[model samples]
Target: MPRARPPLVTVADVRAALWSLVSTAAGLGVAIALVDGVHATNPWSVLLAALVVGVGDALLRAPLRRLARAGGAVGALVLGLGAQVLVVWAALTFLPGITSTSWTAVLAVLVVAGVVMACGHWVLGARDNAYVVGDLLRRARRAAGLPRAALRTAAGPDGAGDDGSGPAADERPAGVLVVMLDGVARPTLEHALQAGLAPTLDRWLGSGSHRLESWWARVPCTTPASTLGLLHGTTDAVPAFRWWSRRLGRMVVTNRPADAAAVERGASDGRGLLADGGVAVSTMFSGDAPTSLLVMSRASEGLGPGQLFVRFFASPFVLVRAVAGTVGETLKELYQGWQQVVRGVRPRVSRRGWYPVLRAVTNVLLRDLNTALVAEQLVRGAPVVCVDLVDYDEIAHHAGPLRPEALRALEGLDRVLGLWEEIARGAPRRYRVVVVSDHGQSLGDTFEQVVGRSFGDEVRRLLRERPPARDVAPRGAASRRGRSDGEAWGPANTALHALRPGRAGEGRVLVGPDRDVPPGPPAEGASATPPAAQPEVAVIGSGNLGMVWFCREPRRLGAAEVALRWPALVPGLLASPAVGLVVVHDDEGPVAHGPGGTHHLASGLVSGRDPLAGYGSRARADLVRVAGLEDAGDLVVVSAVGPLGRVHALEELVGSHGGLGGAQCEALLLYPDDLVVPDDERDDVDGTRMLVGAEAVHRRLVGWLAQLGLREGA
Candidate 1:
């Protein structure tokens, strides 16, 4: 069959095309006037150059986009600039009245093109900006008596029942709005409310219409794991924020798109919490929603209605505001970091890297974008909308969880929530606001700072003290050998190795047929033989949680095997003052050991004092379940807690999660009082029961929607 010709361009298309041409011309004219030592005799010449450049760009856009997708962000940038430079050269050659022909002119054209493209993208490509413009248009239409009702009547039955009223008084709420404040633990938020840092939350807490409740997050309380579980109702195989997979022979970082997608796929049961005309914004996973924005798992897919870049750029005001805000926020973050340093803030990490930029993006750009998108969703009467704001989380990671900076972020988030609440009140459908969090953060000094050495370093020290054998080599020697063989073993790789099953405390050393043998001098009166390659060990730390793996073995090793291989390994780890608890798998089941006593996970029996005494009642069960995962490390270690309720993180984070200690496990949920919780659900330990995990939270939310008559039933 012959392919049909593309549809003829409409008047609107022509208008848009002309707008692009004019915008490009104006941008180029401005650039020419601004560039030093470059003169444009006639503005008409700049317009001619813009016409040439614009036509070229229009012709090349598809190919450029394709190249960008193929080459990634950096490669696409370079390729796009080079292509623009060529286009400018061609324009200069063909255009009349263009006197400038120097490299400086070409550079000016490049800058102009960049500015125009950036502004255009910021307005038209951004979803947040689109919503802003769309909202304004909607309001204008409403003001002119072209209300949503008229549009809905014309569109058909889908818009019929949205008259902002129901048959009965009980049937008030038409939808559910869930706001997830990432990393704001229950205790932290409560303190913020009391301290007046979170005025909106404080008001909500005092309001009789809402009820505040605290819940527990399951083990490995990271965003990916918690969000997947909450959205899809399961987080079966997710080990941690980052974990080594023997099946894949690589480390899987959940924040990465591919890894997040994999995790989403594994956890999903076809029907997600937001499957009923839901919208997910700024979340790690999409909850299988049809519409998603800034969701890591769905990032590879094309931009959805939730993306605000295009819409933002389309509105000059929003675009300029964002650009100005980004500049101001960048400086603000730098000043804040500097202030922290000068103030001698305790338990602070160096926020000198990409942190300042990331902070600005999350706090200013992302926060505003999310607020706009959520308001848009509410106005459009989305059945269920979930948005994740992570400003406090990012700030808390560098500063302490309750630090003034983090508190300020919380205050900002509370204001966004207040805006959402106000928008919901005016929305086409009544919305029951639900506020929750994925997980909480714990504040303390890091293990390396407290112990004066890294976890991997201590493991290496223990390995070096032992005699070298065919299966065991010094960690330093192994690392050097691995580097020489082109298989470099860095700290991260060493952590992965330490979590595997093999000879205990082995550093990452590659041993194969092609491995290079280091030359060495003969011992006294004996011929020298190159040292046997030691198996690599990885000692990875996520927050206070640490995993020790022996990489030489293909399968997870039992504690007995580890003990037999390296007798001093367990003792050395236990002796470390920073290590509070250690759990290792045995032939029977997992066992938890601590300075206080040992707990047998299988029977929940304690040999001496309980190892999980101060952690919580759920700690033993949570640990046992995580230890049973197939990809769990050979040995799991948790940092000790001090008398003042501080836990040491394995990573250099001041505030962290992914282990049981402090306020990390405690999370919060604030929902309207009208939402009913069934007795059966209240008793449900990990499911529809009270909030035990993200899945339970998901269930409760669905139930609330059902009660509000948003869905058919729970």
Candidate 2:
């Protein structure tokens, strides 16, 4: 398994190369004309200068990347500002026919070269994703210096299905790449394919190289819950992205390292989807993967440091382009927000402050870095690799699902798919590319906007009392972040949110509850600590889903108990036009209540108007399962879904999930067709499947892997 031959130059490659040459010359000509004492003797000397610069860049970039990674983000900043110029100056010095009298002359050349490279890459790189992917993979492979034995697995012999005695999975070297496109609804995905927003995906489907299918993202439809099931075969693993864990007596936000680690400890069994030589990238949990990068749960162990900014800014061209893009995107957001204000775009959130910068980072730098990381994983010859691309999700949170910016994020992600597709063709082992979504986003006005108060405020209003409650942060987290944790991830959500006036509900803390009570009892999900002071109830919202739990009770308070404790609360919410349905776990079972009637989940007993109506046929069943969870809220409140398919999000997000309604439950999966039943043998089977829960999706994914000669254990 010697290193594979380099791909032959194609028209695209030739075009890029030609553009590079022309841009270099253009920059050099400017430098010669503008600099005080800079000259190239002949036209050939100019060509030599450009060639030498390319060689200098090639020689310096790897070390620069190393230096950037070692220096962390500060190193990347230094490299972006001056390292490319150093390479340019060094390259200029090599030409015997060229002359630079002073350091200023060299500086002028260096600056011009920097501008040229950045501009050239931006213009060309926008057209291609494979170039970046290939370069990253080559470098990762070169950096690895893997063992000779592992290198032999690159072209391992193909084997048949496991019969019984022989281990076919061990003998075979086929792999699977699962790409989770965050918050992409099936309806939106089809819209993107048809509207030419996702050209690469459209091409694949149109050419019949792939098949598209939709799956139902179940109760508490969210990335944390969905990914938990997919990776670890654990349904009901997470109650919600953010939930009240009475057992811990602290707020559990899955994205936080300690919280994620705690949840993973409870859920993973070492035989997860990634148990066998798998790699996890940019995920909440590692799924027992031997190697995990940018995974929240593994971060506690110092697995993958926050080196994305460092690695990304190491390239001066990328840094300059990204900086420009960030500014442009910031302006675009300001314009778009103003446009929305004037035009009155239905169901949009406030887009202001650091969000624009955050948006640019997620949409540009983060995406590029994540793709590079995945390419590195592929080069490492891992059996399985799963990565989450969150560009669209972040945009849609504020812009709404169908907005131009959100859709554009989808288009950029399509290029990422193309990169992975190309990588699979020459991977160390036979690989199949499959795209999935943890959940989908639902478009909506926020509950506060519709209901005239935030969910917390509403709860307080209903209680008619301001019971003292303390802010309970996670064990390792500060009670107050002030937007700076001061680590590799020191300047993330904390710093960003600190700049803006904190919103009542969400749009504030990105993790954990704003208020919580001390531990109640030692039994049944309660912490060991004794309660000092307790809030009457803890109210937390995940998108459209709102959870209310009585702080004094270790167990879920039943419907009767809820009614007894706060008689006016459920009735008052129902009378309000903003409320849709309120679900409560009864002594008998989970029951749904509406403005008109009550529907028991276990018995299908409808007393008045069926509350779950318009929510879909599966809503009752999903509720039944969610209600059974140990940390299930005492009362689950869902905001009204408007006539136009809008569910009012309990959080500040415009396009949100973690509740049933609209397209939030509908997830799209785009996978290679040949792998899932042979192309010739199967019918044109591209449609939606009723994957009732994330658990079902987990089974389906494991089955797909089994078809690829992988073990079906997970």
Instruction: Tell me, by TM-score, which candidate is best.
Output: 2
Q: How many pairs of residues collide in model 2?
A: 5
Tens digit of lDDT per residue, candidate 2, span 319-397? 4445445565667777887888799888777777556666776676567667777876676567899987878888887
lDDT of 1 by residue, 423-505 (tens): 55445555677888888999898776777776766776776553334322222211221111111111112222222324312
Best-fitting candidate, scored by lDDT:
2
Weakest ten-residue segment in model 2 by summed lDDT:
479-488
- Rate residue 616 of model 2 by lDDT: 73
Candidates' lDDT values, in order?
Answer: 0.64, 0.66
List ranges where model 2 is wrong by over 4 Å.
1-53, 60-89, 92-131, 134-173, 303-316, 467-529, 677-688, 712-714
